[model samples]
Target: MDKYTGKRLDGRYEIHELIGSGGMALVYRAYDEIDDRTVAIKILKDEFLGNEEFIRRFKNESKAIAVLSHPNIVKVYDVSFGDRIQYIVEEYIDGITLKEYLDQQKEVKWKEAIHFTIQILRALQHAHEKGIVHRDIKPQNIMLLQDGTIKVTDFGIARFSRSETRTMTDKAIGSVHYIAPEQARGDLTDEKADIYSVGVMLYEMITGQLPFEADSAVSVAIMQLQADPKPPKEINPNIPDGLEEITLKAMQKNPVQRYQSAAEMLRDIEEFRRNPSIRFQYKYFIDEKPTKYIDAINTVKGTEQPVYNDNYEYEEEPVRNPKKKKKSTASLVITGIAAAFLIVAVGFGLAALLHSCSSGPQDVPLPNFVGHNYDDVKNNPAYKNFKFITETKNDSSQKAGTILGQNPKAGTVVKSNSDVTLTINAGGKMVTIPDLTNKTQDEAVSNLQQLNLTYDVLPVEDANVTKGYVQNTDPPAGTQVAEGSKVSVYVSTGSGGEKVAVPAIIDETLDAAKKDIAAAGLTVGKITTKDDTGKPKDTVIETTPLPGVQVAKGSSVSIVVSSGNKSEKSIDIFVHLPKNVTHDINLKAYLGNELQTEKTVNPSYNDVCQLTFTGTSGKKQLTIQLDGNKYQVYTLDFDAGTFKQDESYPYTENSSASESVSGPITPAD
Candidate 1:
């Protein structure tokens, strides 16, 4: 057994076992006694205790996740930094690593890959907006839940945008296969590096292989810097062209050519999802300068060829004709006399034209009219030269008659009396609200966004409508309202059952508490009695799931009643046997200091067995031993109705009978 296993830290977290180990830290599944929940504690390794760099990275992970709060990102709960021991407590995710899942599945569909990529990008977008760059992103660092949820984890090497300092070992510290070109080259990196990593993961998912792989890490790093990956469609013929383009663009060698941000990449993916056949106008190789076309129809062997240039003007080269006769002396004198007469006539025309232009209206710069009343500006004597074109819009946020916008904009030089259009606010505009009944949350949100309105989602219990679908909208739908008004969307929690908050029933009589529970739409469950010195017999104590916790209507609410005398309570627990138990195995259940039940069960008959225990009324320790190895534990509040099982270790078929299991474990109701 590890040293930290079975130990309590700060008298609060009871560490069960080491779940994972990284280069600088070890993760343990621990129970938070104070919060009454399980959390994963990441403690710095003893070997790196003296290393300041590892310590810094460990602390940085906490700081990075502290500011980030997203559904697709792992959440941090608490941090403890002591001289000898430093650890961060985070949300315990009951899932397997993405790397493990991929290894097991071998091949993933392109659509499924896209679904995963979209979630990862959403998480990165949230982090990037907060100025945090997740420098290390890979399948190994991602957690995959059974419900197809993705959680990005492991920010030990993340960088903040505020800091530009580089560490000593910065080159390819993240996996070389997924690092961006700039990252592989040890160049300064930002959120784009994370995007590049995501692209690599997506490529791997669709192709079932890495884009660039070599015998050594150094060779792979070189490929990341200088090599171009084959298009995903080439490897997987089923991949869509739009998705392949999006992947390659995100994995571009040059940061400028890559998707600038996660949100930008998400938009492209969303478009692809909407229309699979749609192709984006993303040309990878295009001339920066305009192409020049050669002039045709101008080919002379001896003389310079007359040609049309870029400006589209025709120029003719001079050709000498020595053999031609020259009778120009007499003709030149006549031409000069005619030219002088033409110049005199043109001079008179120019003088007349100049005299006409000097009398026209002069040009003046337009003035700004925004934030001012249109009626005042139009009637002012100083603004009498220009013509006012009025356009009104309903804007409840702006004052009535105030100019909301202008056409010519402030400084455009226009002739006097030119038309200037001014848009004025007419107090408020009325828009007919669209019916959002029975629509999904996303559909309703999209409709509201298109109407230039905002919305708030409120989940309510509706027995008729399906969960996550809209039940109704505030202001009821189809009512005329302002364009920018906020609509309240009441979404259905579920059908046939509605959620209700558990009422506080402590200190009430058992009979009265049962009435309250029934009034709250909850059913009274198994009643257990506890020995109490202060409270009267049959007095109400506490209930399961505590107070204020939201539970479904008609759900069981177990009650613990107080008894003045010492009373014995019995509990029935279901035990699931491990798959490795091929032969007959010994299973024992304990209550407090004594063993309650011992049974020999064969695996072929039933994998699960029911264990019954009887103990004196009070809080007692409950342990399950399989083949003489402690496999599970629970705190039996003989007083609190049914037994409360501690989820410190969940059971799985692949788990060894001697070892506690992790990952997905569906509990019995």
Candidate 2:
């Protein structure tokens, strides 16, 4: 039996059984006797009671969860740090860990992953706002209920930002597989580290594998430091590009580059949910002149350096022929007079040109062309003198070829024949839908995405096509459809047979029950047995989702069987006479102090005796007397049907035999 089972603590909580165990504590399913409610009590291990580090971690978990009250976070109800033992009472969660759930699923669908991740982010967002950083955020610490609710647990290494002192040791904590790069390096950690861990978990959820893995923890940690994982899309092509970008952004090696907070990441997830095909254009700046090392060089003296004259000009001056002679002053005067006459004539010609420019065409006010048809505007007599420059763009909100925007105001004045730039809405592009019949879900999604189209999967029961394969698409294949439109892909759900009623197997034998269940298209699941006097042993007492209830084909039916009544029990006892006894002696026996039988035994003939006893449902006391002296006292627990000798006299001088002999002792019988 466990040490804590059936034990009561502080006269209020009664521990039932050990539910889980960890390195520092043992969790028990305990009932609060005072409040009449069940809770999980995490008791510090006896071996670690004196170890300060273990004690601190145990207390840290209690403190961390005590402050958090989110729907997705586990709740702590009470804490006790006694002299002999310490424990924390928390809400009992009846579910498996997320890690186990993921293992069973192998690969989670992107939509399901997003659902779980959104809940987790909401929890983290609350925690981050409260200044708590859950240093460990792996799937193992997440609990998944049957209804798909998530509960984040195990805050053993959590830290509070408001606290001045470090609650955890300097050594690297948390699982190395999902720890952030800074955490692996034992660097200062903040909320962003938790985001990194969440990103790793999301990657694993969608890709069915961890971002980094190796034979040893050290190798994995090293990979966390230096290696860049392949994007989730490469592993699972069905993952949306926007989701992949969000995941990778959160997993950035530099904390400064990752999502600044969980709320930011949640916003991106919301955007992805609203428009699955939406892609975020994220950009990061890279320093072109990154620091580098250079070779050492010898020093130069000031005189060794090249010098240039400040007054020197590098341009060459036009040179004159040395043989040429200068002209006379009178000839120079005549040339100057002709130059003056040419200047006067050029001034009069420039005045005539200015007078002609002043008589140009008049300006006109440009009309609004944003919503007007391009053809109408081009043929309008009022705008015949103006030029129109059109650019086309795909805008789903507006009609095809409609002018969306214009550069200048409608009332702005411009010269005739001036350019008027306009942006036209070209609407959605049309593309021929490829044949998607019999294609795998991933392959179909990839093909649709390549054509700038989105898809919705509708799973149908198909007896011919395989599961996860496309049976056919809506609008059929080879049909022309607008780009960015949603296509319905009919996915096969395998051959799900007709639903059948569950047959009643109560009071039937195990083999018979199994046959009946199989005949009803169901299999046995989690058979359990209990003591029941109403039914024979190995007979089915009851079943889960009771008989006659309709269930899908191949569903499992759990059953409980009878292990017989608890009252029917019997035991045999054997005894030997003492060697010192020389004469014939009378032996008497009593059960529960009531006379049973009396007999005489001769030592020379036989020295051993055998007896049988049967009873109802409680412990029975057996007493034997030899020659009127008490020989042995035994206890027989009729409930379990086991016997043990309490004490033996071994033939003493005192004798007190009082019962009448029922028969003469036969030879050793």
TM-score of candidate 1 against the unseen true structure: 0.43
Colliding pairs, model 1:
none
* Model 2 spans with C-alpha error above 4 angstroms: 165-170, 285-669
lDDT of 1 at 338: 80
Q: Residues 311-348, candidate 2, lDDT per residue (tens digit)?
A: 11111222323674554567877879876897688655
- Where does candidate 1 have its weakest 10-residue lDDT segment? 307-316
Task: For residue 592, give model 1's deviation from the true position in Å.
Answer: 78
lDDT tens digits, residues 179-239, model 1? Answer: 8877664556789999999999999999999999987666676677667798887898767
Q: After aligning candidate 2 to the native by TM-score, how far in Å is the CA of 129 from where it should be?
A: 1.6
RMSD of each: 32.2, 36.8
Reference-based TM-score of each model: 0.43, 0.45
Q: Find the candidate with the highest TM-score and give its number.
A: 2
